[model samples]
Target: MLKLVVNNDLHVNKKDTITCKNSCDLFDEITGECSINQGVDIDSPYEAARCGFFIHRDSMSVPEIKDHTHFKFSLMDDIDDDLLDDQEIFHQLVGKSIYKEEYTYPLKPDFSSYRDDAKWFVSPCGSYGCWIVNHYKKPLSIPKSKDVAERGWNNRVYKSPIPLHDHQSALPISSKMAWLIDEDGFGQYALLVNGKISSISAPKPINWKRH
Candidate 1:
């Protein structure tokens, strides 16, 4: 079953509350007001990401528009319950929500090989430096909740859902793609380049929109 929690200006439930020190410019510190026109309800982390909400790093709660507390959480009866079983869905949500810089063409087209060429593309992981993907490294811990709306980011490379493929990730092509690689490295929903898989990484944070 899908679970939901609603929050508003008058009452903020601990389960649905989102807090950050300097996250949103739209929030009014004195009045506790959120100036955005966020909808009353968001059903999934995927949907929340599309709306530019982000998972707070410290709280590990469902991402929300800070100060835009008038929100209602509900399950979409039409969504397949089986799809919710995939923990990869949470990983996708984190990848989608975080802001990252992307390049259409290879950063260095003259690299000796596709593997070397792929390394030129970098993820501006917030204030951190380049995200290093090591094939031999273990995946970082992330929220294991099956509830899509409750998932949060864990400040690490998003692990691939498929076993033995932890270093790679998949995200939807939001705006562009310009080169082809001969490697299959992404999960489903990734934009294929010449029938090969591409790596995915989370970007920096995005601010909530103001009305």
Candidate 2:
């Protein structure tokens, strides 16, 4: 299963027990019986209660890369209408001009192609951006860890390439900010200025190898 490490502290195994915030039925449909606080398993109950949950996409299943041109991109924190309606804040964070690029799959990809494995960058609009690499490639491998205690799924794994010390200034006004580095340190996934996770599936199981 996918292993998620946050700030090099919290570790969670990706499993059915994990829950999502924006993707939850209650958050989306309002009338749905589903609740956001159900079935969550974080190591620390205090952190779990405060951190809540987030949906981390694992794959992209569009018929063709061309079809993804208009895919919506937004920050996970902007799910509420009250937050999204802040046009001034959105523009300040995402900017105005943006670019787009098409990518052909590097390796033959199955129908379950994922974007995290491909080369792409976020746009200024905080929506979709350009694909710097081939789009046809399959998604990157899930991160793994030797420590069982650190071998769990987590939503924070969706955040990677985090802002460095110099980039901290952008954090306050930034519209998007999320990055995840697999346990193996081979792959990376980042959120758009808006907050969309690159993939569709939840974190996958990590393939741990005994030393």
Summarize candidate 1's per-residue lDDT along 18-85 as a digit string, tens digits.
Answer: 43223433233333432222331322434334433333334322332232122222222343556456
Residue 17: error of model 1 in Å?
Answer: 6.2
Q: Note each model's CA RMSD in angstroms.
A: 19.3, 17.9
lDDT of 1 at 64: 24
Instruction: List the global CA lDDT of all models.
Output: 0.28, 0.30
- Model 2: weakest 10-residue lDDT segment is 59-68
lDDT by residue (88-144, candidate 2, tens digit) is 333323322121143222121111213454343453333332322222234443323
Model 2 alpha-carbon drift over 4 Å, by segment: 1-27, 30-185, 194-211
Q: Let me know the TM-score candidate 1 reaches against the reference structure.
A: 0.18
Task: Look at candidate 1 and tell me the lDDT of residue 92.
Answer: 33
- Model 1: how far residue 75 lies from native, Å: 12
